[model samples]
Target: MSVPILKQGEILIASIQSALSDRELVELRDELADRVGRLRSRGVVIDVTALDVLDSFATRTIRGIAYTAKLRGAKTVVVGIQPEVAFAMVQLGLSLDGIATALDLEEGMLLLQRWPK
Candidate 1:
């Protein structure tokens, strides 16, 4: 299934509600980039609260999406990461190097709101 991308003010929120295959993840990345450009979004928030597992490919795809959005002049914040997923990502050395993160969607929105345009 395609992930739902919602627009709130100048921010685009993508809530990942299921496990995505590599192909789906790639599609999401492209869709997000296109939307960011077309909508002239100031920020993007990717919510992964429903996901229980995150593989290396998924992690990298998210990072790629963040970078791509940044190139299009939008900041990206990843929120709602489960503890297990966080541990696994760190264990795998798949650090979200340059990406910003928040504890929840509310904080994520706040972060984007305060982010420099």
Candidate 2:
């Protein structure tokens, strides 16, 4: 599976770096909705540590992603933003304002698992 999903007890772990077309992302979101069905409680901790830069399109995709995750009864926590990139995003005003971010993956997952209901 190009988008490999990991099972960790009740949580689903995914490290996403897919450079998909907008249409493809929409399709992926639909598939993700199906995958997350029937879960009592769940969350996603996305490690975007490898992506050096984020443009408008990517940022929009992430926003849509958070929305999709919410629809599937899950929350999304993003981690691993390089300082330089953060600066760039800040200058571009692309900082993920409402989305959660963390210093590292460990902290991000902790925050996601402990998210308020």
Candidate that would win on TM-score: 1
lDDT scores of the candidates, listed in order:
0.93, 0.69
Badly placed stretches (over 4 Å) of model 1 are none
| TM-score for each candidate, following the candidate numbering | 0.96, 0.78
Best-fitting candidate, measured by lDDT? Answer: 1
Q: Which stretches of candidate 2 lie over 4 Å from their true place?
A: 17-28, 38-41
105: Cα error in model 1, Å: 0.6
Which residue pairs of candidate 2 clash? none
